[model samples]
Target: MQKFPAVLSVALLLAGCAMSSTQFDATREALRGSPPLRQQAIADCTANQARRSLQARQDAARVMNVSVRAMPRTICTRLVAGWSSGRLSYDDYRSAMVGSMTPNTVRIIQGR
Candidate 1:
């Protein structure tokens, strides 16, 4: 029983490490449809990701018996700014999303 719990915890932790390539491919396909649509899609995707992260934080806090607080509003601001300024390519944005969580966020999620 102890070994099972340890193994399961490791699996879950690794699962959150990064996004899969398939996810990036799908995003790329969606972005390729129309030149004008790219901006809207990117904005929407970023917003969705932020919202999901907030929700996940809340859920983790509850599971860990910790107090829930608002996440920083600027979490996705840098990403959007970089994208808007052409400082970030689609590949860079995708990789950023996959590795978006900060060390603090990871610590909270792991209940450390």
Candidate 2:
């Protein structure tokens, strides 16, 4: 049926939205350990985030894509706190990190 194509397309789009392994590893490393370690990780994360965001932006432009305009600076206090305090599991935190940094999420935040 015609609906099959639409359903499959939606599935593929969602699957493509996952964060890459490099981002996952960096975040995992940053989430654990002492305050000083976290501080250093935050610095590294922000720098990497900026570079990756720029590359993503340029790639999207080249592809004439509108789905993801950017990757926000993902190192934030709330995420760190949640992860540090065990309020959020590593997987959940990773999902939240990706969700929070989406272009749509940024739009919502800015509008509020």
- Tens-place lDDT digits, model 2, residues 1-112: 1111111121112223455556545445565657876565445443443444454435423332232333222323333444445543434434333332333222221231
**Model 1, CA-based lDDT:** 0.38
* Model 2 alpha-carbon drift over 4 Å, by segment: 1-33, 54-74, 93-112
Q: Tens-digit lDDT track for model 1 on 1-105?
A: 011122112212212344455654444455455545555544543444344545554554454354444222222233333333444344443433443433433
How does residue 72 of candidate 2 score in lDDT? 26
Instruction: Candidate 1: count the clashes.
Output: 0
The lDDT for every candidate, in the order shown, is 0.38, 0.37
TM-score of each: 0.28, 0.36
Q: Name the 10 consecutive residues with the lowest summed lDDT in model 1.
A: 1-10
Q: What is the lDDT of residue 43 in candidate 1?
A: 52
Q: Tell me the deviation in Å of residue 4 in model 1.
A: 25
